[model samples]
Target: MTSHGTTTEECSPTPPTAEPATPSPGLYNADLAPTARKGRTWRSYSIFTLWANDVHSLGNYAFAIGLFALGLGGWQILLALGLGGVFLFLLLNLSGFMGEKTGVPFPVMSRIAFGIRGAQIPALVRGAVAVAWFGIQTYLASVVLRVLIVAVAPGTASWDTNRFLGLSTLGWISFLALWAVQMVIVSYGMELIRKYEAFAGPIILITMASLAIWMFGKAGGSIAWSTPATKTGFDMWRQIVGGASLWVAIYGTFVLNFCDFTRNAVSRRAIVRGNFFGIPLNMLLFGAIVVVLAGAQFKIDGKVIESPADIVKTVPDTFLLVLACLALLVLTVAVNLMANFVAPIYALSNLFPRVLDFRRAGLVSGVVGLVILPWNMYNSPAVISYFLGGLGALLGPLFGIVMADYWLVRRSRVDVPSLYSDRPGGPYHYARGVNVRAVVALVPTAAAALLMAFVPAFHAVSDFSWFIGAGLGVVVYLLVADRKGPFAEASGEAIAVPSKR
Candidate 1:
């Protein structure tokens, strides 16, 4: 999510403090604090590349095609995906500015609304959600490796014929190998991740564009758009809404976690500008390509191919198949390391501040993700729906709470020092380490949303759970919030982080 907010130094005064320990070591670990006022240097292009960083994965591609399974035509699916992209861009911009303005990560920014210590609740919530997707995405990435291995070494096909604990022997080998590859990249930290995206984004786009063009040519450059997927004449609107909602659910968690990325941007406009192209434009383009590819599959193969790996599997040219898999492998590794791995590391760090720095937190997150066997959870539509919807259920309320706190309650001013200070009665100090009100608001809202997600009878409403839960969170938080504070008005220190020497 590309969010909006002036960093604390940009718009709010520095609260009472000792020099903040330079980078705020330990209790106010500098890594977790508002970035230094003079250090914001990320530009618009950097922001645009983020979607490429996050979306260039097998799952994102499959998800685009899955939208068409709703029985909508290419045009309808495009519209829905584009609109969902717009919603994502807007929602992310709403949150992104706060990170830029405040120059702090999501959990740190949540202090005002959830309270300093209480902020951990949302942090852990997002972290757990990240872990789920992290493992799931990691598993999804390994599919490319599986394809590459089988394409090159046909004898390994027997591994697919056999099974153990939900995956075959070769599958297990590929998964662990891919997992290790990701761990290696993540260990190098964000700077390297940044460089990886910059390098891989263009190549991935070119490769997918080539595949789509090739498929379109084979299909005779024409597409027979499908009829309404779920309903007849007038009720087609419902199908479109359902499709759009699914896209939103896929997008829900990112907006909530966007602060982790936006905090690194040097200028507020950089994120917003990047988001304009990144979310709506990029999704439409990618979705169109996938829709065409799916449509082409009917002519080129037989049925709509669910996975691109299937497309690569059919390629008669060994060299071309290997090349496609290589692009995909690069894409998947980048997505796992950048999208799923980063936020969870921060979440875990927030959870055990003194004990777990980012590296240690990455170890903890990676370990937990491995134990969950995310592969078992990722392969089926029903399972994916339930899994992603459940995640959205948690995300919606957090998005609402944070948005409400930043936009309505605090009015954008934050006591930056108090966010890190251990002093009692500090601006964010509430109850004993937890803000009961935010909990009160988050629990039932999320519970109802979760039921909507997993309960078959309520499943029809599951896609909209994010929207509904967010509305509920806003109402509940508004009712319990303090009537006034420093953040009550939109006033603060105005200084940009200077360029680093």
Candidate 2:
């Protein structure tokens, strides 16, 4: 599958004895090294678990069920989700191959395309996006927890009356409680997270299946899979496209920083195998069950309920109610850690390698998540559409530039040590540690994407900002980058990595 150019086959079976032999104060750090082969312990199941935990969250469940409200049938929703899953799966493998081969996280990998110091720009952008989502996820989880507490105690329900900053008094307590729990768990580091994720993934899937079964019985086994045939032709096609875009948007956060997890993978095969089961298969199964639940609920009553937590609240059985709530709590924590927490930690560490380690970076991430007051951002559909959509616009062009630089321009060859060097003529040190071509490509494309997302006239295409930005980035970079400059200088210098051990 690989040769000397643009393929992981060039990677050594084992890493070097001492990768740096000497560290660069500003660029190289212990946390940023290429993972050693011995420490690459993640199997195919680990990757599967990672995606399972990431996908099976309350927000995602609500999203899948909500597509029905858009007038898409069950089969139609599945088709859109299925196509989106395949699209994401292909990209994950492409990026995962790089991480498995190099054993470096996304921030370190960015150095290849963005230059060492210039790498900070993409890193910070990714980190900021993560910060916003972290808060949103945490708040979502807190809402569920508060529901559970109210169900159990009832006295705590009084606290819901008082409001502050768009959240109730109980909401503040619940949010802070979940926030602290996450801070403690994440500070312990990735190994603990890896272990918990493997355990949490299957349990959440089972709980979801159980919920579907109970809801199915509630509707007496009769549920509508499709709405009445209302619109046809181009209008219907537009909904399908929009549904597919929503599916992809659901996973946009992981697209840039998947390498944060894949860097620990035992092999590229593991990543590919895991992603196959984790994404398309998992998404299909999960969507099917969600269809059953939403359909049954609609069958029993004419009203539509989008939030799974709210659906759980309507359950007559207390045991099932408590169980679903707990499962959702675990599911959100698992996703929050893997998707929102880890990426920012790595990004922040990369930005201030001299001042921050993983633990410190995680602390900063938690604080920023709180500061963002994500409850406000998530309270309104308009806010969510503008805020999150705008953030996503930034990443697409960055992804395009990175992928294009690795596969097209340099042909996958990377100078490992030079990435850590600020030496005047170092391979990655292009014009004072910043690649002008990348910046130029990024600014215009990102701006265009933001305009599409924020402007009312561009609403039709706003959902496609990521694709537009990425395509533009690829086209612009290819046109502007110095094809023969760094690639020629660092032609044969494959990475000699030494990661965990």
Candidate 3:
């Protein structure tokens, strides 16, 4: 019998080579099982490049340059990015530790807190948001791809100008083409993703640096760092805080399911080392380049062009323009796959471990991303706000509950076998395989956060909706669930390290 008191036949298709350590059939599938240490080949540089590509993208470029519009100087904006990066680094570490130690994905780790069946709730919520982002990122990447299409086929200029479903005919072709390519990439699974990210991240990082150098040369090598609207004193501090909050909010989705990648990490040290260079340092370095480019553009054009693709188009050299466009396209795809693709793929796989494997789940996610008509959603500020903010509120609570339960209530002990066990009286089984207290705790906290997002009266504090939900989620879970009875501490070894074999 495998662990969780089930025979190997019931829990998995293949008989176990090692007894007790292997996960069960119902909750355990090859996709969700603990990753073998031998398979954990992602070094710190793999992770660093992952962040490098993730940070250097069209949307991120726009976000960084647009901060000047908020009256923040270059220094203040860099400071804000740094602050957000620190918060993001800390959160990724806390969430990643569970995965690195136990070698499980986020949805699987959630079982320890939400019960086996109940884990589906958070999984589905995260999946929905991921699907939305997948579509949005695909649309954004298509915008850059349109540049290539237009450049290659000058006759398609008419196609670019004509509009349908809020996107031009050229836009549709580009979006669908990029969409198909990404599906093929995901079909190959995680190893391909790791390798692709390693290649894509550093190339785009160099491309952006080159673009910055070109912009500086255009401006005779000297540019003003501060904009005309730069603010100071109390107003500056307020913008700094808001900028920091917005920066963290931008990554709220990745923060929740970071373990999807960390599970492949070779060690806790690898995870930390990668995240350090990947997040804060990389963010600051990229932000600095963005500031310099924006300033140089303002000097030449009398206004900053927020879209990097648009900036690329202004270049007179055909080769550099094509190269920059291709680099931006690759950067967009890198972030989309790394930030938006993996989470939903794993979430859907966990939803029906028996029926859906990685490739199949990726197809489902890709289809959903295509049909969402993401261009419409991405074009609207109010809609994006409500959509992302509402989802962020819901996600924050899940993070809070999982962290609180794992670190505080259970003291990090995980009966790995119990996570897959559907049997009554199993450690994670709870009442009817559902943790009602967790659901009960989730309701009010999520509701409170959602209200902050949806209600206009609460707009002032909506930026902090994630913080509110997470804080309330931790407090409420601790209040309702102590280490006794249904919430008893896990008994057994604290963790079963994944086999090196």
Q: Please provide TM-scores, in order, for all candidate models, with all chains considered together.
A: 0.89, 0.92, 0.91
Candidate 3: where are CA atoms >4 Å away? 1-24, 161-166, 380-383, 485-501
lDDT of each: 0.73, 0.80, 0.80
- Model 2 residue 258 distance off true place after TM-score fit, in angstroms: 0.8
Instruction: Please write out the lDDT profile of model 1 over residues 75-192, one tens digit for every residue.
Output: 8778877778888888888888877766777878777788767888788777777788888877776777888898899999888777887888988998888888777767766666
lDDT for position 137 in model 3: 89
Number of the candidate with higher TM-score, 2 or 3 = 2
Runs off by more than 4 Å, candidate 1: 1-26, 155-166, 227-232, 300-302, 379-391, 488-501
Model 1: which ten-residue window has the lowest total lDDT?
488-497
- After superposing candidate 2 on the true structure, give the runs of residues whose Cα lies further than 4 Å from its correct spot: 1-22, 164-166, 380-385, 485-501
User: How displaced is residue 1 in candidate 1, in Å?
Assistant: 18
**lDDT per residue as tens, model 3, 264-381:** 7777778788999999999999888988888888888778777777778887877777788889888988999988888888888888888888899999999988887888888888
Q: Residues 1-501, candidate 2, lDDT per residue (tens digit)? A: 342222353543223323332447787666776666555667899999998887778778778777787777778778878888888898888788777766778998898888888899888888878888999999999999998888888899999999898889999999999999999988887777888899999898898888888888889977878666424578777777777776776676677778888888877778888999999999899878878877887787766678777678887777777888889999999999998899899898898889888899899999999988899878878767766666777888888899899888987666555677777766778889888889988889888878877888998987677777778989999999889853532211233344332
Q: Give model 2 RMSD, 1 decimal.
A: 3.2
Q: Pick the candidate with the highest TM-score.
A: 2
TM-score of 1: 0.89
